[model samples]
Target chain A: MTCKEAFQEISKYLDGELSEELKRALHEHVGRCAHCKVVFDTTVKTIELYCDGKLFPMPENIRNRLHDLLRRKFHERAV
Target chain B: MHYTSMMALEVNRLEKGTDRLTGKSMSAQPQKATERAESELIAEAKAGNGDAFEELVNRYERRIYRLALRLVGNTQDAEDVLQETFLKAFEHLPDFREDSRFYTWIVRIAVNEGLMKLRKRKSDRSEPIEDAVDDQGQVMPREFRDWKPNPEQLLSQEEMERVLLDAAHKLPASLRTVFMLRDVEELSTGETAEALGLTPGAVKARLFRARFQLREELSKVFKSEKSLDL
Candidate 1:
Protein backbone atom coordinates (compact mmCIF):
# COMPACT_ATOMS: atom_id res chain seq x y z
CA MET A 1 0.00 0.00 0.00
CA THR A 2 1.08 3.55 -0.65
CA CYS A 3 2.05 5.78 2.28
CA LYS A 4 -1.10 7.89 1.95
CA GLU A 5 -3.31 4.81 1.88
CA ALA A 6 -1.51 3.35 4.88
CA PHE A 7 -1.76 6.60 6.87
CA GLN A 8 -5.50 6.78 6.33
CA GLU A 9 -5.97 3.22 7.57
CA ILE A 10 -3.77 3.66 10.64
CA SER A 11 -6.67 4.45 12.93
CA LYS A 12 -8.60 1.41 11.79
CA TYR A 13 -5.54 -0.74 12.06
CA LEU A 14 -4.93 0.32 15.65
CA ASP A 15 -8.60 -0.23 16.44
CA GLY A 16 -8.32 -3.75 15.05
CA GLU A 17 -11.27 -3.00 12.83
CA LEU A 18 -9.37 -3.11 9.59
CA SER A 19 -10.03 -5.93 7.18
CA GLU A 20 -7.46 -8.71 7.28
CA GLU A 21 -6.17 -7.82 3.83
CA LEU A 22 -5.77 -4.15 4.67
CA LYS A 23 -4.29 -4.95 8.05
CA ARG A 24 -1.69 -7.17 6.50
CA ALA A 25 -0.88 -4.57 3.86
CA LEU A 26 -0.54 -1.84 6.48
CA HIS A 27 1.59 -4.04 8.67
CA GLU A 28 3.86 -4.63 5.76
CA HIS A 29 4.11 -0.91 5.06
CA VAL A 30 4.93 -0.08 8.69
CA GLY A 31 7.54 -2.77 8.81
CA ARG A 32 9.43 -1.11 6.00
CA CYS A 33 8.65 2.53 6.81
CA ALA A 34 9.98 4.32 9.87
CA HIS A 35 7.75 7.42 9.54
CA CYS A 36 4.55 5.43 9.17
CA LYS A 37 5.54 3.25 12.09
CA VAL A 38 6.01 6.26 14.34
CA VAL A 39 2.64 7.69 13.40
CA PHE A 40 0.94 4.37 14.01
CA ASP A 41 2.59 3.86 17.37
CA THR A 42 1.70 7.36 18.53
CA THR A 43 -1.93 7.01 17.55
CA VAL A 44 -2.26 3.67 19.35
CA LYS A 45 -0.62 4.95 22.52
CA THR A 46 -2.82 8.03 22.60
CA ILE A 47 -5.97 5.98 22.30
CA GLU A 48 -4.75 3.64 25.03
CA LEU A 49 -4.03 6.58 27.34
CA TYR A 50 -7.50 8.03 26.91
CA CYS A 51 -9.21 4.66 27.18
CA ASP A 52 -7.32 3.81 30.36
CA GLY A 53 -8.84 6.88 32.07
CA LYS A 54 -5.42 7.92 33.28
CA LEU A 55 -5.61 11.39 31.81
CA PHE A 56 -8.19 12.95 34.11
CA PRO A 57 -9.60 12.36 37.55
CA MET A 58 -12.70 14.23 38.60
CA PRO A 59 -12.22 15.50 42.15
CA GLU A 60 -14.57 13.93 44.71
CA ASN A 61 -15.33 17.25 46.42
CA ILE A 62 -16.35 18.88 43.16
CA ARG A 63 -18.64 15.99 42.36
CA ASN A 64 -20.27 16.17 45.82
CA ARG A 65 -20.77 19.92 45.59
CA LEU A 66 -22.46 19.69 42.21
CA HIS A 67 -24.73 16.96 43.56
CA ASP A 68 -25.67 19.15 46.50
CA LEU A 69 -26.44 22.07 44.23
CA LEU A 70 -28.66 19.96 42.02
CA ARG A 71 -30.47 18.51 45.02
CA ARG A 72 -31.03 21.97 46.47
CA LYS A 73 -32.42 23.27 43.20
CA PHE A 74 -34.74 20.29 42.97
CA HIS A 75 -36.02 20.83 46.53
CA GLU A 76 -36.64 24.55 45.95
CA ARG A 77 -38.67 23.77 42.87
CA ALA A 78 -40.66 21.15 44.79
CA VAL A 79 -41.70 23.74 47.37
CA MET B 1 -28.16 -15.09 23.99
CA HIS B 2 -25.75 -17.24 25.90
CA TYR B 3 -24.59 -14.40 28.10
CA THR B 4 -28.15 -13.35 28.81
CA SER B 5 -29.14 -16.86 29.76
CA MET B 6 -26.10 -17.21 31.97
CA MET B 7 -26.96 -13.99 33.73
CA ALA B 8 -30.53 -15.17 34.20
CA LEU B 9 -29.35 -18.43 35.66
CA GLU B 10 -27.05 -16.64 38.07
CA VAL B 11 -29.88 -14.37 39.16
CA ASN B 12 -32.09 -17.41 39.70
CA ARG B 13 -29.42 -19.06 41.80
CA LEU B 14 -29.12 -15.97 43.94
CA GLU B 15 -32.90 -15.81 44.35
CA LYS B 16 -32.99 -19.43 45.44
CA GLY B 17 -30.24 -18.80 47.96
CA THR B 18 -32.05 -15.80 49.40
CA ASP B 19 -35.30 -17.77 49.64
CA ARG B 20 -33.59 -20.63 51.45
CA LEU B 21 -31.87 -18.24 53.87
CA THR B 22 -35.17 -16.51 54.71
CA GLY B 23 -36.94 -19.86 55.30
CA LYS B 24 -39.81 -18.71 53.15
CA SER B 25 -40.72 -18.59 49.45
CA MET B 26 -39.78 -15.12 48.37
CA SER B 27 -41.90 -13.85 45.50
CA ALA B 28 -39.75 -11.11 43.93
CA GLN B 29 -41.01 -8.75 46.63
CA PRO B 30 -37.88 -6.59 46.59
CA GLN B 31 -37.96 -6.24 42.80
CA LYS B 32 -41.61 -5.24 42.86
CA ALA B 33 -41.00 -2.66 45.56
CA THR B 34 -38.06 -1.17 43.67
CA GLU B 35 -40.06 -1.04 40.45
CA ARG B 36 -42.96 0.62 42.22
CA ALA B 37 -40.69 3.20 43.80
CA GLU B 38 -39.12 3.95 40.43
CA SER B 39 -42.50 4.44 38.78
CA GLU B 40 -43.75 6.64 41.60
CA LEU B 41 -40.65 8.79 41.46
CA ILE B 42 -40.97 9.22 37.74
CA ALA B 43 -44.66 10.03 38.02
CA GLU B 44 -44.18 12.52 40.85
CA ALA B 45 -41.25 14.16 39.14
CA LYS B 46 -43.30 14.53 35.99
CA ALA B 47 -46.03 16.21 37.99
CA GLY B 48 -43.83 19.18 38.83
CA ASN B 49 -42.34 17.50 41.85
CA GLY B 50 -39.25 19.45 42.95
CA ASP B 51 -38.30 16.74 45.40
CA ALA B 52 -38.38 14.20 42.60
CA PHE B 53 -36.10 16.42 40.58
CA GLU B 54 -33.73 16.56 43.54
CA GLU B 55 -33.72 12.79 43.70
CA LEU B 56 -32.91 12.58 40.05
CA VAL B 57 -30.09 15.09 40.52
CA ASN B 58 -28.70 13.09 43.40
CA ARG B 59 -28.66 10.02 41.21
CA TYR B 60 -26.80 11.67 38.31
CA GLU B 61 -24.79 14.45 39.94
CA ARG B 62 -21.42 12.75 39.83
CA ARG B 63 -21.73 11.81 36.18
CA ILE B 64 -22.92 15.28 35.19
CA TYR B 65 -20.16 16.97 37.15
CA ARG B 66 -17.48 14.80 35.61
CA LEU B 67 -18.86 15.47 32.14
CA ALA B 68 -18.78 19.21 32.77
CA LEU B 69 -15.30 19.12 34.23
CA ARG B 70 -13.91 17.17 31.27
CA LEU B 71 -15.59 19.47 28.76
CA VAL B 72 -14.62 22.78 30.39
CA GLY B 73 -11.08 21.77 31.53
CA ASN B 74 -11.37 23.83 34.72
CA THR B 75 -13.03 23.37 38.08
CA GLN B 76 -14.73 26.80 38.27
CA ASP B 77 -16.08 26.74 34.74
CA ALA B 78 -17.25 23.18 35.19
CA GLU B 79 -19.14 24.09 38.37
CA ASP B 80 -20.80 27.03 36.68
CA VAL B 81 -21.78 24.89 33.72
CA LEU B 82 -23.12 22.14 35.99
CA GLN B 83 -25.38 24.58 37.87
CA GLU B 84 -26.63 26.14 34.66
CA THR B 85 -27.36 22.74 33.18
CA PHE B 86 -29.47 21.63 36.18
CA LEU B 87 -31.27 24.96 36.38
CA LYS B 88 -32.19 24.85 32.72
CA ALA B 89 -33.34 21.26 32.97
CA PHE B 90 -35.54 22.11 35.93
CA GLU B 91 -37.14 25.07 34.15
CA HIS B 92 -37.86 23.00 31.08
CA LEU B 93 -38.96 19.83 32.84
CA PRO B 94 -42.55 20.29 31.84
CA ASP B 95 -41.62 20.46 28.18
CA PHE B 96 -39.46 17.37 28.20
CA ARG B 97 -40.44 14.87 25.53
CA GLU B 98 -40.75 11.39 26.96
CA ASP B 99 -39.57 9.66 23.80
CA SER B 100 -35.90 9.95 24.76
CA ARG B 101 -34.27 8.87 27.96
CA PHE B 102 -34.12 11.67 30.53
CA TYR B 103 -30.42 11.16 31.10
CA THR B 104 -29.69 11.48 27.38
CA TRP B 105 -31.76 14.65 27.10
CA ILE B 106 -30.13 16.21 30.14
CA VAL B 107 -26.71 15.32 28.82
CA ARG B 108 -27.49 17.04 25.54
CA ILE B 109 -28.46 20.19 27.39
CA ALA B 110 -25.35 20.13 29.56
CA VAL B 111 -23.14 19.70 26.49
CA ASN B 112 -24.77 22.62 24.72
CA GLU B 113 -24.38 24.84 27.76
CA GLY B 114 -20.72 23.89 28.05
CA LEU B 115 -20.19 24.68 24.36
CA MET B 116 -21.81 28.06 24.80
CA LYS B 117 -19.44 28.93 27.62
CA LEU B 118 -16.47 27.84 25.53
CA ARG B 119 -17.65 29.98 22.60
CA LYS B 120 -18.02 33.03 24.80
CA ARG B 121 -14.55 32.53 26.20
CA LYS B 122 -13.07 32.15 22.73
CA SER B 123 -14.72 35.33 21.47
CA ASP B 124 -13.53 37.24 24.51
CA ARG B 125 -9.96 36.12 23.97
CA SER B 126 -9.97 37.53 20.40
CA GLU B 127 -7.39 34.98 19.34
CA PRO B 128 -7.96 32.98 16.20
CA ILE B 129 -8.87 29.47 17.28
CA GLU B 130 -6.88 26.90 15.33
CA ASP B 131 -8.46 23.58 16.20
CA ALA B 132 -5.94 21.26 14.60
CA VAL B 133 -2.27 21.47 13.98
CA ASP B 134 -1.58 21.60 10.31
CA ASP B 135 1.67 20.29 8.85
CA GLN B 136 3.17 23.76 9.14
CA GLY B 137 3.23 23.66 12.94
CA GLN B 138 2.65 27.43 12.97
CA VAL B 139 -0.25 27.38 15.42
CA MET B 140 1.05 24.27 17.24
CA PRO B 141 -1.86 21.91 16.67
CA ARG B 142 -2.54 19.23 19.25
CA GLU B 143 -1.49 15.73 18.11
CA PHE B 144 0.05 12.69 19.73
CA ARG B 145 3.74 12.07 19.38
CA ASP B 146 5.26 8.67 18.85
CA TRP B 147 6.34 7.22 22.15
CA LYS B 148 10.06 7.52 22.70
CA PRO B 149 12.33 6.44 25.47
CA ASN B 150 11.63 8.40 28.60
CA PRO B 151 14.94 10.19 28.88
CA GLU B 152 14.46 12.46 31.86
CA GLN B 153 11.11 11.11 33.10
CA LEU B 154 11.19 13.97 35.56
CA LEU B 155 7.61 15.09 35.00
CA SER B 156 5.48 14.27 38.02
CA GLN B 157 2.08 12.77 37.58
CA GLU B 158 0.49 16.13 38.46
CA GLU B 159 2.60 17.93 35.87
CA MET B 160 1.60 15.48 33.18
CA GLU B 161 -2.05 15.86 34.12
CA ARG B 162 -1.79 19.63 33.92
CA VAL B 163 -0.15 19.38 30.51
CA LEU B 164 -2.89 17.09 29.25
CA LEU B 165 -5.58 19.47 30.55
CA ASP B 166 -3.86 22.44 28.98
CA ALA B 167 -3.65 20.69 25.63
CA ALA B 168 -7.33 19.83 25.76
CA HIS B 169 -8.23 23.46 26.52
CA LYS B 170 -6.16 24.67 23.59
CA LEU B 171 -8.28 22.61 21.18
CA PRO B 172 -10.88 24.65 19.27
CA ALA B 173 -14.23 24.75 20.99
CA SER B 174 -15.98 22.59 18.43
CA LEU B 175 -13.31 19.91 18.15
CA ARG B 176 -12.63 20.03 21.87
CA THR B 177 -16.29 19.39 22.66
CA VAL B 178 -16.34 16.38 20.37
CA PHE B 179 -13.16 15.02 21.96
CA MET B 180 -14.55 15.49 25.45
CA LEU B 181 -17.87 13.88 24.65
CA ARG B 182 -16.46 10.98 22.69
CA ASP B 183 -13.21 10.27 24.54
CA VAL B 184 -13.76 11.58 28.05
CA GLU B 185 -17.50 10.98 28.47
CA GLU B 186 -17.44 7.81 26.34
CA LEU B 187 -20.53 8.83 24.41
CA SER B 188 -21.35 6.90 21.26
CA THR B 189 -20.76 8.59 17.90
CA GLY B 190 -24.48 8.92 17.28
CA GLU B 191 -25.09 10.42 20.68
CA THR B 192 -22.18 12.79 20.23
CA ALA B 193 -23.46 13.83 16.83
CA GLU B 194 -26.91 14.45 18.29
CA ALA B 195 -25.52 16.45 21.17
CA LEU B 196 -23.33 18.61 18.90
CA GLY B 197 -25.79 18.88 16.00
CA LEU B 198 -23.23 17.38 13.70
CA THR B 199 -23.56 14.46 11.34
CA PRO B 200 -22.09 11.15 12.51
CA GLY B 201 -19.38 11.35 9.85
CA ALA B 202 -18.54 14.88 10.93
CA VAL B 203 -18.27 13.79 14.52
CA LYS B 204 -15.93 10.98 13.56
CA ALA B 205 -13.76 13.25 11.45
CA ARG B 206 -13.53 15.87 14.17
CA LEU B 207 -12.70 13.22 16.74
CA PHE B 208 -9.97 11.72 14.59
CA ARG B 209 -8.45 15.13 14.00
CA ALA B 210 -8.76 16.07 17.64
CA ARG B 211 -7.04 12.92 18.80
CA PHE B 212 -4.26 13.43 16.32
CA GLN B 213 -3.69 16.98 17.49
CA LEU B 214 -3.83 16.13 21.18
CA ARG B 215 -1.31 13.33 20.83
CA GLU B 216 1.04 15.66 19.02
CA GLU B 217 0.79 18.32 21.70
CA LEU B 218 1.25 15.84 24.51
CA SER B 219 4.36 14.43 22.86
CA LYS B 220 5.83 17.90 22.48
CA VAL B 221 5.27 18.64 26.13
CA PHE B 222 6.89 15.40 27.22
CA LYS B 223 9.82 15.86 24.86
CA SER B 224 10.48 19.43 26.04
CA GLU B 225 10.43 18.34 29.63
CA LYS B 226 13.01 15.72 28.80
CA SER B 227 15.26 18.30 27.17
CA LEU B 228 14.92 20.68 30.14
CA ASP B 229 16.17 17.93 32.41
CA LEU B 230 19.39 17.66 30.43
Candidate 2:
Protein backbone atom coordinates (compact mmCIF):
# COMPACT_ATOMS: atom_id res chain seq x y z
CA MET A 1 0.00 0.00 0.00
CA THR A 2 1.16 3.51 -0.79
CA CYS A 3 1.64 6.13 1.96
CA LYS A 4 -1.56 7.92 1.08
CA GLU A 5 -3.43 4.65 1.03
CA ALA A 6 -1.87 3.70 4.34
CA PHE A 7 -2.97 6.98 5.85
CA GLN A 8 -6.49 6.53 4.56
CA GLU A 9 -6.72 2.95 5.79
CA ILE A 10 -5.44 3.75 9.28
CA SER A 11 -8.96 4.32 10.60
CA LYS A 12 -10.28 1.14 9.05
CA TYR A 13 -7.44 -0.88 10.50
CA LEU A 14 -7.92 0.53 13.99
CA ASP A 15 -11.66 0.11 13.73
CA GLY A 16 -11.39 -3.58 12.79
CA GLU A 17 -13.33 -2.83 9.65
CA LEU A 18 -10.61 -3.79 7.20
CA SER A 19 -10.95 -6.96 5.12
CA GLU A 20 -8.36 -9.62 5.89
CA GLU A 21 -6.75 -9.13 2.49
CA LEU A 22 -6.53 -5.36 2.96
CA LYS A 23 -5.25 -5.88 6.51
CA ARG A 24 -2.45 -8.03 5.15
CA ALA A 25 -1.52 -5.40 2.57
CA LEU A 26 -1.48 -2.66 5.24
CA HIS A 27 0.74 -4.74 7.52
CA GLU A 28 3.09 -5.54 4.67
CA HIS A 29 3.32 -1.90 3.61
CA VAL A 30 4.00 -0.61 7.10
CA GLY A 31 6.55 -3.37 7.72
CA ARG A 32 8.56 -2.51 4.62
CA CYS A 33 8.43 1.28 5.10
CA ALA A 34 10.01 2.75 8.24
CA HIS A 35 8.17 6.03 7.90
CA CYS A 36 4.79 4.40 7.52
CA LYS A 37 5.67 2.01 10.33
CA VAL A 38 6.26 4.95 12.67
CA VAL A 39 2.99 6.50 11.72
CA PHE A 40 1.27 3.15 12.15
CA ASP A 41 2.81 2.36 15.56
CA THR A 42 2.13 5.82 16.93
CA THR A 43 -1.40 5.64 15.61
CA VAL A 44 -1.96 2.28 17.27
CA LYS A 45 -0.76 3.72 20.55
CA THR A 46 -2.86 6.83 20.11
CA ILE A 47 -6.05 4.87 19.55
CA GLU A 48 -5.35 2.68 22.57
CA LEU A 49 -4.77 5.67 24.80
CA TYR A 50 -7.78 7.54 23.51
CA CYS A 51 -9.99 4.51 23.97
CA ASP A 52 -9.44 4.83 27.69
CA GLY A 53 -12.93 5.99 28.62
CA LYS A 54 -11.81 6.12 32.23
CA LEU A 55 -9.19 8.83 31.61
CA PHE A 56 -11.65 11.50 32.68
CA PRO A 57 -13.71 10.05 35.48
CA MET A 58 -16.62 12.03 36.80
CA PRO A 59 -15.80 13.47 40.19
CA GLU A 60 -17.83 12.22 43.15
CA ASN A 61 -19.00 15.75 43.91
CA ILE A 62 -20.46 16.16 40.43
CA ARG A 63 -22.01 12.74 40.57
CA ASN A 64 -23.75 13.55 43.84
CA ARG A 65 -24.82 16.94 42.55
CA LEU A 66 -26.31 15.34 39.46
CA HIS A 67 -28.11 12.79 41.60
CA ASP A 68 -29.53 15.42 43.95
CA LEU A 69 -30.59 17.63 41.10
CA LEU A 70 -32.31 14.75 39.38
CA ARG A 71 -34.16 13.89 42.58
CA ARG A 72 -35.45 17.42 43.05
CA LYS A 73 -36.44 17.83 39.42
CA PHE A 74 -38.20 14.52 39.20
CA HIS A 75 -39.99 15.12 42.50
CA GLU A 76 -41.20 18.48 41.26
CA ARG A 77 -42.42 16.96 38.04
CA ALA A 78 -44.26 14.23 39.94
CA VAL A 79 -46.07 16.77 42.05
CA MET B 1 -24.62 -10.74 39.07
CA HIS B 2 -21.94 -8.85 37.21
CA TYR B 3 -23.19 -5.84 35.28
CA THR B 4 -22.64 -6.84 31.67
CA SER B 5 -22.72 -10.59 32.07
CA MET B 6 -25.97 -10.30 33.98
CA MET B 7 -27.30 -7.88 31.41
CA ALA B 8 -26.11 -10.27 28.73
CA LEU B 9 -28.31 -13.04 30.03
CA GLU B 10 -31.52 -11.00 30.18
CA VAL B 11 -31.34 -8.95 27.01
CA ASN B 12 -29.91 -9.11 23.53
CA ARG B 13 -29.30 -5.98 21.55
CA LEU B 14 -32.40 -6.46 19.46
CA GLU B 15 -31.11 -3.77 17.20
CA LYS B 16 -27.91 -5.72 16.75
CA GLY B 17 -29.80 -8.85 15.90
CA THR B 18 -31.70 -7.30 13.01
CA ASP B 19 -29.15 -4.75 12.01
CA ARG B 20 -29.59 -4.69 8.25
CA LEU B 21 -25.89 -4.53 7.59
CA THR B 22 -24.84 -7.46 9.75
CA GLY B 23 -28.13 -9.39 10.04
CA LYS B 24 -26.18 -11.94 12.01
CA SER B 25 -27.90 -12.53 15.34
CA MET B 26 -31.36 -11.35 16.23
CA SER B 27 -31.81 -14.00 18.90
CA ALA B 28 -28.26 -14.15 20.17
CA GLN B 29 -28.47 -15.18 23.84
CA PRO B 30 -26.00 -12.79 25.46
CA GLN B 31 -27.12 -9.70 23.59
CA LYS B 32 -30.73 -10.52 24.33
CA ALA B 33 -30.05 -10.25 28.06
CA THR B 34 -28.48 -6.80 27.76
CA GLU B 35 -31.35 -5.38 25.73
CA ARG B 36 -33.93 -6.89 28.05
CA ALA B 37 -32.47 -5.24 31.14
CA GLU B 38 -32.02 -1.91 29.42
CA SER B 39 -35.49 -2.07 28.00
CA GLU B 40 -36.81 -2.69 31.49
CA LEU B 41 -34.97 0.33 32.82
CA ILE B 42 -36.44 2.54 30.14
CA ALA B 43 -39.91 1.19 30.77
CA GLU B 44 -39.56 1.76 34.49
CA ALA B 45 -38.28 5.29 33.95
CA LYS B 46 -41.17 6.04 31.67
CA ALA B 47 -43.54 4.91 34.39
CA GLY B 48 -42.29 7.49 36.90
CA ASN B 49 -39.45 5.50 38.37
CA GLY B 50 -36.75 8.03 39.27
CA ASP B 51 -34.47 5.27 40.50
CA ALA B 52 -34.63 3.53 37.13
CA PHE B 53 -33.66 6.66 35.26
CA GLU B 54 -30.76 7.26 37.62
CA GLU B 55 -29.52 3.75 37.04
CA LEU B 56 -29.35 4.60 33.38
CA VAL B 57 -27.52 7.84 34.23
CA ASN B 58 -25.04 5.98 36.41
CA ARG B 59 -24.13 3.78 33.48
CA TYR B 60 -23.23 6.67 31.20
CA GLU B 61 -22.31 9.71 33.36
CA ARG B 62 -18.53 9.42 33.10
CA ARG B 63 -18.57 9.03 29.34
CA ILE B 64 -21.05 11.84 28.89
CA TYR B 65 -19.11 14.08 31.22
CA ARG B 66 -15.84 13.30 29.49
CA LEU B 67 -17.33 14.19 26.13
CA ALA B 68 -18.67 17.42 27.56
CA LEU B 69 -15.31 18.28 29.10
CA ARG B 70 -13.50 17.64 25.85
CA LEU B 71 -16.00 19.54 23.74
CA VAL B 72 -16.40 22.67 25.87
CA GLY B 73 -12.76 22.68 27.06
CA ASN B 74 -13.33 23.02 30.81
CA THR B 75 -14.73 21.27 33.85
CA GLN B 76 -17.21 24.07 34.66
CA ASP B 77 -18.91 24.09 31.29
CA ALA B 78 -18.67 20.32 31.05
CA GLU B 79 -20.65 20.13 34.29
CA ASP B 80 -23.36 22.35 32.87
CA VAL B 81 -23.62 20.30 29.70
CA LEU B 82 -23.88 17.10 31.70
CA GLN B 83 -26.60 18.57 33.92
CA GLU B 84 -28.59 19.91 30.99
CA THR B 85 -28.32 16.69 29.02
CA PHE B 86 -29.70 14.47 31.79
CA LEU B 87 -32.41 16.94 32.73
CA LYS B 88 -33.56 17.04 29.16
CA ALA B 89 -33.33 13.30 28.85
CA PHE B 90 -35.37 12.84 31.99
CA GLU B 91 -38.08 15.24 30.86
CA HIS B 92 -38.24 13.57 27.49
CA LEU B 93 -38.11 10.02 28.74
CA PRO B 94 -41.77 9.49 27.95
CA ASP B 95 -41.17 10.43 24.36
CA PHE B 96 -38.17 8.20 23.81
CA ARG B 97 -38.74 5.78 20.97
CA GLU B 98 -37.39 2.42 22.01
CA ASP B 99 -35.98 1.67 18.58
CA SER B 100 -32.70 3.39 19.39
CA ARG B 101 -30.34 2.76 22.25
CA PHE B 102 -30.86 5.10 25.20
CA TYR B 103 -27.17 5.87 25.09
CA THR B 104 -27.42 6.99 21.46
CA TRP B 105 -30.39 9.20 22.22
CA ILE B 106 -28.77 10.86 25.22
CA VAL B 107 -25.52 11.44 23.35
CA ARG B 108 -27.40 13.42 20.74
CA ILE B 109 -28.70 15.69 23.48
CA ALA B 110 -25.22 16.04 24.98
CA VAL B 111 -23.69 17.02 21.66
CA ASN B 112 -26.30 19.70 21.11
CA GLU B 113 -25.86 21.02 24.61
CA GLY B 114 -22.07 21.00 24.21
CA LEU B 115 -22.17 22.88 20.92
CA MET B 116 -24.56 25.46 22.29
CA LYS B 117 -22.33 26.04 25.29
CA LEU B 118 -19.40 26.24 22.90
CA ARG B 119 -21.00 29.05 20.90
CA LYS B 120 -21.85 31.11 23.97
CA ARG B 121 -18.57 30.26 25.72
CA LYS B 122 -16.45 31.19 22.68
CA SER B 123 -17.20 34.92 23.01
CA ASP B 124 -14.29 34.91 25.42
CA ARG B 125 -12.39 32.03 23.80
CA SER B 126 -9.33 34.02 22.86
CA GLU B 127 -8.32 32.95 19.37
CA PRO B 128 -10.41 29.79 19.36
CA ILE B 129 -9.24 26.87 17.23
CA GLU B 130 -12.08 27.55 14.79
CA ASP B 131 -10.46 30.89 13.97
CA ALA B 132 -7.56 29.06 12.37
CA VAL B 133 -9.88 28.00 9.58
CA ASP B 134 -10.18 31.13 7.51
CA ASP B 135 -10.93 28.97 4.52
CA GLN B 136 -12.76 25.67 4.95
CA GLY B 137 -9.95 23.98 3.05
CA GLN B 138 -7.35 25.41 5.41
CA VAL B 139 -9.20 23.98 8.40
CA MET B 140 -7.80 20.52 7.68
CA PRO B 141 -4.23 19.97 8.90
CA ARG B 142 -2.14 17.84 6.55
CA GLU B 143 1.53 18.40 7.37
CA PHE B 144 2.37 14.88 8.54
CA ARG B 145 5.84 13.75 9.65
CA ASP B 146 7.17 10.29 10.36
CA TRP B 147 7.64 10.42 14.10
CA LYS B 148 7.49 7.45 16.43
CA PRO B 149 7.77 7.48 20.19
CA ASN B 150 11.42 6.61 20.59
CA PRO B 151 12.39 4.52 23.64
CA GLU B 152 14.95 7.03 24.96
CA GLN B 153 12.53 9.94 24.55
CA LEU B 154 9.48 7.99 25.70
CA LEU B 155 7.64 9.80 28.40
CA SER B 156 5.92 8.12 31.32
CA GLN B 157 2.44 6.72 30.70
CA GLU B 158 0.76 9.53 32.61
CA GLU B 159 2.66 12.18 30.64
CA MET B 160 1.86 10.53 27.34
CA GLU B 161 -1.80 10.38 28.37
CA ARG B 162 -1.75 14.08 29.13
CA VAL B 163 -0.31 14.77 25.70
CA LEU B 164 -2.97 12.59 24.11
CA LEU B 165 -5.74 14.49 25.90
CA ASP B 166 -4.23 17.77 24.77
CA ALA B 167 -4.17 16.64 21.16
CA ALA B 168 -7.79 15.47 21.39
CA HIS B 169 -8.88 18.79 22.84
CA LYS B 170 -7.30 20.59 19.90
CA LEU B 171 -9.64 18.82 17.51
CA PRO B 172 -12.71 20.75 16.34
CA ALA B 173 -15.92 19.96 18.24
CA SER B 174 -17.46 18.08 15.34
CA LEU B 175 -14.45 15.88 14.79
CA ARG B 176 -13.88 15.37 18.50
CA THR B 177 -17.38 14.08 19.14
CA VAL B 178 -17.16 11.67 16.24
CA PHE B 179 -13.80 10.40 17.39
CA MET B 180 -14.88 10.08 21.00
CA LEU B 181 -18.05 8.11 20.39
CA ARG B 182 -16.64 5.88 17.68
CA ASP B 183 -13.21 5.22 19.11
CA VAL B 184 -13.48 5.66 22.85
CA GLU B 185 -17.08 4.66 23.37
CA GLU B 186 -16.72 1.89 20.79
CA LEU B 187 -20.02 2.65 19.17
CA SER B 188 -20.56 1.24 15.73
CA THR B 189 -19.90 3.59 12.81
CA GLY B 190 -23.59 3.57 11.99
CA GLU B 191 -24.50 4.47 15.56
CA THR B 192 -22.00 7.33 15.57
CA ALA B 193 -23.49 8.62 12.32
CA GLU B 194 -26.97 8.33 13.76
CA ALA B 195 -26.01 10.11 16.96
CA LEU B 196 -24.45 12.98 15.01
CA GLY B 197 -27.24 13.01 12.40
CA LEU B 198 -24.79 12.39 9.55
CA THR B 199 -24.27 9.74 6.92
CA PRO B 200 -21.90 6.91 7.76
CA GLY B 201 -19.67 8.21 4.99
CA ALA B 202 -19.57 11.62 6.62
CA VAL B 203 -18.68 10.05 9.97
CA LYS B 204 -15.81 8.17 8.34
CA ALA B 205 -14.50 11.34 6.70
CA ARG B 206 -14.47 13.26 9.97
CA LEU B 207 -12.96 10.29 11.79
CA PHE B 208 -10.14 10.15 9.23
CA ARG B 209 -9.45 13.84 9.65
CA ALA B 210 -9.54 13.54 13.46
CA ARG B 211 -7.19 10.54 13.48
CA PHE B 212 -4.76 12.16 11.08
CA GLN B 213 -4.67 15.39 13.06
CA LEU B 214 -4.12 13.50 16.32
CA ARG B 215 -1.41 11.27 14.82
CA GLU B 216 0.49 14.28 13.49
CA GLU B 217 0.20 16.34 16.67
CA LEU B 218 1.33 13.39 18.80
CA SER B 219 4.30 12.84 16.47
CA LYS B 220 5.70 16.24 17.41
CA VAL B 221 5.91 15.19 21.05
CA PHE B 222 7.19 11.65 20.51
CA LYS B 223 8.93 11.70 17.14
CA SER B 224 12.67 12.35 17.24
CA GLU B 225 13.83 15.50 15.46
CA LYS B 226 15.91 13.35 13.10
CA SER B 227 13.63 12.74 10.14
CA LEU B 228 13.62 9.64 7.97
CA ASP B 229 12.88 9.44 4.24
CA LEU B 230 10.28 6.94 3.03
- Top model by DockQ, which number? 2
- lDDT (tens digit, per residue) of candidate 2 on B167-197: 8777777777787777666577898988878
Candidate 1, chain B, TM-score (2 decimals): 0.67
| Candidate topping TM-score | 2
Ten contiguous residues with the weakest lDDT in model 1 chain B: B20-29
Error of 2 at B17 (Å): 17
Fill in the DockQ of model 2: 0.39
TM-score of each: 0.70, 0.78
In candidate 1, stretches whose alpha carbon ends up further than 4 angstroms from where it belongs are A13-17, A51-56, B1-44, B48-55, B127-145, B149-155, B223-230
**What is candidate 1's CAPRI-style docking category based on DockQ?**
acceptable
lDDT of 1 by residue, B1-230 (tens): 44324323333433343221232442312343444353465567778776777777665556676677767778788888888888888788778776665666778999888877777787677522444554223322233234555422546656765666677766777777777666555566787888778898878777777777777866775443222111
